[model samples]
Target: MVEETIKLAYGEYSDLIKDKRIAAVQALSGTGACRLFADFQKRFSPNSHIYIPVPTWSNHHNIWRDANVPQRTFHYYHPDTKDLDFASLMDDVKFSQNAPKGSFFLLHACAHNPTGVDPTEEQWKEMSYQFKVKGHFAFFDMAYQWFASGDPEKDVKSIGIFLEDGHLIGCS
Candidate 1:
C-alpha cells in the first residue's frame, strides 16, 4: 500500500524529484503529508509556529494542532465577495512581522476545495517574497494537482513561485 502510494505521488510530483529540484517524499494522502510535515517542523524548529491560511481545509488545523505545533492564521477568502481577499491577505502577511525566523508554512497547491478560490499568479509571487523575507519554510500539499486545470503543472502555480525564489521544497 505504501509503495503504491509512493509511486502515485512520485508520478504526480515527478517534475520536482527528477530534476533534483526538491527534496520530496511520498505520503499516504493529503492528510498524511500534512501530518508528516508537521512532525518534521516540530522536530527541527521546535519554537516556530505554522502560519495557516484562514478558510483552509479544516483537517489542516487538526493535523498541525495534533502535532503540537503552534498555529497562526493569515487572511485568505473574502466572505463578502466569495473570492480571495488579496489585499487583506497581503496586509495580514505583512503584519506577521514576527512569525519567527525559519518558521513553517503550508500552501494548498491548487483547486482549493469547498470554496474553490485560488490566489492569482501575481499574488503567489508576492506571497513567496513575503515567505522569503520572513524566513519561512514551505511544505506544499499538492494532493489535487491535476484537478484545478486538468494539468498537474498548472495546478501547482503556487509551488512554482516558491521554487522560483530558490526555496527548498517538499511536495507530495
Candidate 2:
C-alpha cells in the first residue's frame, strides 16, 4: 500500500544488511531509550557507574540518577575549541584512575545534541582502541542518526568502527 520505489529501496537495503552481533530494543524516544538502558545497567551491574559526556542531554543525568546509579562525568566538549576535547577525554578514560574498569560510558553516536560536535573517524578509532584497552562498554544514543550528515550510512561509520574494534555496544 506504500510507494513502490520506497519499498524497492527498502528491500535492497535490507538485503545488503548482514547480521552483526548487535542487540537492540524499541523505545518511543531518546528519553525512553536512555531510561531503558539505565534500568538495565542498574539491574545487572548495580555496582557500576555510568560515565556521561560533559554536555549531553539533560535527561541523561536524570535517567541514571532515577535508576539509582551513580554518575561520573568525562571531558567531551571543549568550550574554547567548540569541538571534541579528545586528549582530555582520553586522559579521563586512561589516567583518571577513578573510573572502575569495565564501566559503562554513554556515547552520542552522531550529531551530539546542544553542541552538534562529533569526533573524527580517526578519533573514533583511537577512542575505540582506548576503550578496548580500558575494558569500557560503549552505550550509544543514536537519536539523530542521519540528522547530522543527511546520510544515515555515513552516520553509522562511528558505530561500525566501534564494532570493528570488537566493542560490545548497546544501542537503541
In candidate 2, what residue range of length 10 has the lowest lDDT sum? 1-10
Cα-based TM-score, every candidate: 0.83, 0.86
lDDT of 2 by residue, 1-172 (tens): 2233222212233422334233444576778878999899999998999999999988898888999999999999999988899888988778647566798899998899879999999999998998898899998888787788998777777877886787777765
What residue runs in model 1 are displaced by over 4 Å at the alpha carbon? 1-21
Model 1 Cα lDDT, one tens digit per residue, 88-169? 8777666657455666777777877657888889889998898788677877777687788887657767876777687876
Total residue pair clashes for candidate 1: 0
